[model samples]
Target: MKELKAFLKSKDVSKSEIFKALKISYDEGLILQYLCQLFFGSIPNISILNLLQGLFKDKEEFSYLDHLKDIRHLMELGLVKTGYSMLQDQNKESLFSLLHMDISLSEYFLQFLENKKPLDLSINVAYENHLEYLKDEFERIKLYTRLSFNPQNLDFKKDIQAYEAHIKKRLAKSKFYNVLAEIFKENKLSKKEQIIFIALLKEEYSLKNEESSSRELNSLLALVSENELEKLKNRALLDENSKLIEKNLIDYDEFSNHFYLSESILQRIVNFKRLDKDKQLRLENALKDQEIFELIEPNTDINDVIMPAKTKELLENILKQQDKKVLERLSLWGIKNSKEVEAKIIFYGPAGTGKTMSALSMAKSMKKVVLSFDCSKILSKWVGESEQNVRKIFDTYKEIAQNCKQSPILLLNEADQFLSTRVESGASADKMHNQMQNIFLEQIEKFSGVIIATTNFLESLDSAFSRRFEYKIEFKKPNFKERFLIWQKALPKNAEFSEDFKLDDLAQYELSGAQIFMVVKNTALKVAVSKDGIFSMQDFRESIEKELSSSFDKSKIVGF
Candidate 1:
């Protein structure tokens, strides 16, 4: 008490107990002395205008610039604390607005300044849980947010270094920081990218928002973006080419202009406690009971089929989504809204054509399982059941998708009757058919996965249905060229052929690819049992005649 009295009575400000507690300069100490006197004399806190008035009472010693500089200096020293009413002002950057800010000695300093006691400024501020860390870190991040708008942001880098150091100090105790640091290390994120990730995480945990809009994300990103152009550059980090998105660490909803954590990363990084099931296992369990879909693992791909050049090109384009650059371009062009590729396609042509085969093959090309639903099964003998059956198709698909990570291709085969035009009729059957079509149309419009429905002819499709397809592929009955190729492909490699057998003669038969396949199989059987053991044109020709003949004779069973 005697040492303090000597210091207070002396002119040396450094020896004052208040200066020793705050560890501030002589000029800052002088500023704090007046603030402390006014704080208890009138109120616990002082208005910015009054604080200014009291601090610069001797105007000749300090200029107005010195007053403004001193105020910022006090703020920098953490001596003067400003309330939200000042920070929340949109025009807080203006001089008139700064005067409205209410200021006070920090609560930490107030105790010591009033008691004339030494202040202990040391304590472990590290948070114990992820939520607490997010809460504290979120507030700290807002300081940078305000700094972004302030022109007096000369100490920006210093502030950032301190924030980083604080985070590093807490990393050992903060699971959020540890997990996020691991992600950053794995993805090799730059300093700016790390800032963006932390801000997004703050938005997620602190705000309890799963997604942030582009505008909201941009403002949060202003910590790194110094100007409009730099902001554009920061925006590019969320674009299609972004490593954050390309690495599957982030997800974007293009339709909503929102960015969120990807599922693959969210479960690993976030501390949310929602119980989630293993969807792959759930899908496996559910698949055991379903009878409507014939699950197929196709042995063929798009390359294995012989189709029209135009058809081949279109299918190739659909498969192009597998390419990263192609997928990125798709999202950039707004052709795709999600990261995954989606298709609603129609394969319409003759019965013997390759519609069903192509659909299955396309699935194989994309490495997806096929859920082939015979459209005939959708029709029920019971009335009003067809619409329910149609609904069941989509409902079952959703269940499978939700229960599985990789969605299967939904292939609706032989859908001629379903795709037929809806009649404006009052009859029960017509009403039922129309209602079923409406349900089908609605599902098709909203469906975001691969769905290919095949009918015999595109002309059979209602215009409404036709418009819903991203691809309208027609499969013409194989002409001589395609049939020739099919014949070459279908020829049994293990079989022997007679010297006189000619492929041109077989290709000349105006037979569809299916007929040619049957011709080869039947001919191979006939030749296998022959004494000569050779595949001859005569053997194939006889099979062709038998296959082409529609009529069946009961007596033919005795032909052997």
Candidate 2:
């Protein structure tokens, strides 16, 4: 009673506020005094209705107090016994019977007490259902007080410790612990639950003897495999200050030079601590091999391409030999061993030839995804940054490959300018060029993935750089037969052409397959756009002239 009086008299609270909070009737101040006395140790003789009326007079203003009133009413109705006698008796069945009756009365009283606080009936039901198992009198008191006032201030650590204590107390008196042990032996827990349970067991038990401790530890460790144990240990070691370099030393500067992404983006990705469990799982799945090949675009097969028959046969044999060698090397190391094969192909040819198409065709034939690297996009004007960006791109590709469980085809388009062997004459531009080229060569040689590089001016490329590729395919201008087929493929299926539409005669103009296709497309567009649905020879001639004129003008501007 003195403690309650002191609490009520605190500067932060007032008697009027307590009266409003408890929703007590003006006449029932004496009843409140009696309750305070009983709480602090005093006996009282008052009708349960008088106590309920005092606590629930203005249920709308102080509905939380109504639950305490219901408890008292249930006691009066003989649905429950006052004090902790029922809990201490261990008569769970009898306790449950009384609880059921109390619950029904509580519900009726709650309905009668209209405009009350929004109480969670489910929580109340759960508490009632588990009341028999709640053995910690201190915890029960703390929980009740918190729920009655500020539930938000409830301490999880205190609750968990109290729950553990309750379990321990029950295990000391019953066969519950032995039953739990049998259940654990018969069933496997999920990885997350296993970790938590193992941690809990470790905290609860401390073996006095070394052998017994070892046995217990071994039993806990048996829940996970050796590899999983190592993984758990590794993960445990990765705290906030953990660095990537600690596990595996990477040449960050060299890596940066090869990938064109910004250091900030790379750092953000590398240092990203997965906060969400689902997101972490997603990241883990992405790291698997299934998603790797999807990052690359589909490439065309070079073998099916039409060219000079001799050249085609010679190149096909070379590619076949290279493929065999790659397989042999891979087999020597072991199948599914990605470390042995150095997958690089070089395609050299004049401008307007099929070098790029050949690389695409090769990828298509192999049924592999191809990713074209735009050197211009990776190369930066800022000093040192270009190499870093290039490295990042390669690293990204490598990560994609690791996740997808497949090697991606890296199509380094326009390989001549950067890969050229020309030495710098101590000029800044040449120095930059040399640095970038060296980084590219180093990365390509070390890369386990497939690479296809195309060069228009083979002579201009450094011989040293040219030697690195396993196969060199030359793309020549399409011959007459090939040219005729190109025209057939390019033209729309429904278009009607006269006998004078001779592709062999058109081949005499020395037009590339792309140029021929462009001409056909332009001529078709003109015919379609015209008011009359007619294909005219004049339209074809005009399209050809227009293309030729543009090419001639561009060549003159370059002083070719």
Candidate 3:
């Protein structure tokens, strides 16, 4: 009773208000009124009349006038409405107008009753109760079925289980379930395709972040026997399932001998909140990224970046063409006929020259996200694994690009290993390397999204790969004037430079833009550590000398 009072109070009403509004004197009538709201959304006039006659039939004090008074109060409060006006002639001729409850309040009240099951009434238990109802329904529907029919005849137990599974899946609000239901209902799916799909779903649910539980098709082969697979293959030409691939409902990795359900579908099934709490958390952990690809928000604006004038001009023009309006206009004039626009660019030069910075800056100017692929993490020692990883990277980029207003830029920093020269196939290992290069070439040609790759050795890149790049901007070590600007940009405005600290004199050393930044950073660190955070000529000179020494050691190793 205390819980019941708390429940009503939580809804901004008291237990007395419920009794007064419903015009009920007994607690039984109030309990019935609340239950009526939960199941039927509102207590109809006839329902209230019936409840009172049934619950308080022995009580001589309860009368018809009592119900009418309560109904009128409920109407006045705007909590309920009559289907037809009570004062109208239509109501006098037949039954009284039916009362309808406010759906918003009814739902809110239902939630309130759920936490505190006053009089054992609850809407929160509806889903669980529905399963019991479905079980009865299953038995009723299968009553006439016989087990002696054929070997493939619907086994009553299996049929009931499948039906229950289907119902549970339909309860999900995920687009994956909606799409799956629609496709299976609209199209004639062969038993083999159906089996494959069910296997995929089963594998999808079985994944956990703690284990290597990837739902790869090869992994699923163990779940179903080879004999069963052969039978499914006989019923459908495997090629018939190509439509699924085209729709991206699933992906088949030919190299790995594995099939992958679309990430979107996997994400949906894993994230559906109806699953057990532990199971839901485990699925989330499994699907979480390894952080191999870093998401870089636009931080460096293009104008503030120092680059060759020609490079800046090229980037601006390319980005402008990528604008939706520009592309639409281009299509109208038949100037650009591709279904989607893409700009493949290469930024190549000596180490530390600002190639990577240029990519980040341009991304900022265009208001696009940058997905930086970690080359070391992606390249694998296993033969086929590396190629598969590369495919996953591109596929992920496509998925991310589709969800953004402006497609993100895929940045491959120090891309020499991926875009390296395709040597003659002198050995099996060499052939695999060439194969990797070919796969990259094919994917890049089909790609309709922006990509920027930076490399220190432009000469090491395969000619075929270089030719595919729409723009190749060489990042030369900054000239004296550019170096001075770079140095000025690096300086802290609050810091006072020594009178002898001449940037023009410092720029005489053949240092890259990155080296200049490093010198500034180190000089600042030195001031903070030794000079009580004061900027001076000695700190700057020491930092510059240290950078020169490191550069000389690197040049000896590479003969640069």
Candidate 4:
């Protein structure tokens, strides 16, 4: 109290603690002391003319015009806000008009003068909902942006860091953070992009018109860059291939050189609900309204799938999305825009091959959901609506993809029904088929996610549809080695087997993975009900013959 009094009064201010806390030049400190008194004495806002009049009245020797530069310096330091337009020009005429311009101390500084103690610099605010969290985040963004006013002061950087750490800790307690958390969990955006999103979001919250939220491209680049070289590099964030642009989170105006939040984000602002859920919950609800797609959460790992060595290697490569460096390298090479390993694949082979199994196992390996669609059902269900349900398949998949943080695997079983060679000219029915094929082709061309289409006849697919896929893997019937592994894996460990029941004998049969699975099940059923509870060679031979004889049964059934 005595030090503040001494500092405020005309005395040797060097000994005052308030002077020390000001941390400014003696000349600047003298000007700030006058502003501090003005805050206490007047309406907390004063014109430059009145400020200078008071200063000269109190100290007749004071050269108020020379100290106008000091006032501008104080404005840069955020000790003062230079009216509404901080970017006002500093020409002689503008400086002359500044004598009548109104200014005020920053809220931060004013709070300090009111209490005579430093404000609580620590962030300790707890938010109960996402709305509160967003509002507080908006204020923090404004604070950091204001700090950018004096970028030369490294201390402002430290202050922004301190506030950032505090906000992050506070955010960690919430289950959701709106779009920011959504994009982060999806691995679709970097922090620089997240800042740009939140900044535009804040502008939307303020009572400004639409155009005010749109910022100049150079200013946004400056927000994310520390130097000119870095700014030049950051221009790619607005590139056509960047995630911010590709995901449709931000829209850029080429003619005006401005960037704004996309309409999707703006629509979400008014009624922003939780954009995240528990990972398991997301898998559970991903198919709630997916009438054409069945969501499957797979437990089988790719290692369990019996396949050729090359096939296994390719399946394992799909898990590269789990490796940060691999994803980064792919992104660097421009192979993938987002962190996800986007793939359009065709797993083709005869029936009973392991196309669907491998697809589910690959999804499990990546910890993603599988939205499996039966393309055969398209022809079956489109009976009353022939070929009309083609576009709905891709649209439903896209809707599911948006809700899933991890891009769900789109498994199109029996896609050959539509992807077969398109009919060029024929009757009305043939024209409808061609139109359906054309729509299907358009969707696949624009589709950007992990997608796998399984077909019994890859040879029948149209060249146009085949060209859209980046991978065309053949899932042939397992040979002797693969069949042996499949037989060994499918056999029940708990069921009793006769001493003569050798897997090598079963492996001798040329069975696909699905056929082997069925044979083992049928043979196990026989042993389960038998008196001895044993699986003899006769029971196995009978089951294998039954499966081979029923090869005409081309029905497909999937289980998790």
lDDT of each: 0.68, 0.49, 0.58, 0.71
Summing lDDT over every window of 10 consecutive residues in candidate 4, give the lowest-scoring window.
84-93
lDDT of 1 by residue, 276-381 (tens): 4565466666666666777677889899999989889989988778666777788899887665658899988767778888988988777677888888888877
Q: Where is model 2 poorest over a 10-residue stretch in terms of lDDT?
A: 102-111
Which candidate number would show the highest lDDT if scored against the true structure? 4
Which regions in candidate 3 have their CA more than 4 angstroms from the true location?
1-288, 322-329, 337-341, 402-405, 552-560
TM-score (C-alpha, index-matched) for candidate 2: 0.44
Candidate 2 vs candidate 3, TM-score winner: 3
Cα error, candidate 4, residue 15 (Å): 40
* Candidate 3 per-residue lDDT over residues 176-280, each given as its tens digit: 224344445433565445445555554444453311212333223322223334424442222324545544456555444346666855664444333355754
**Number of clashing pairs, model 2?**
27
- What does the lDDT come to for candidate 1? 0.68
Clashing pairs in 3: none
Candidate 2 or 4, higher lDDT? Answer: 4
RMSD of 3: 21.1
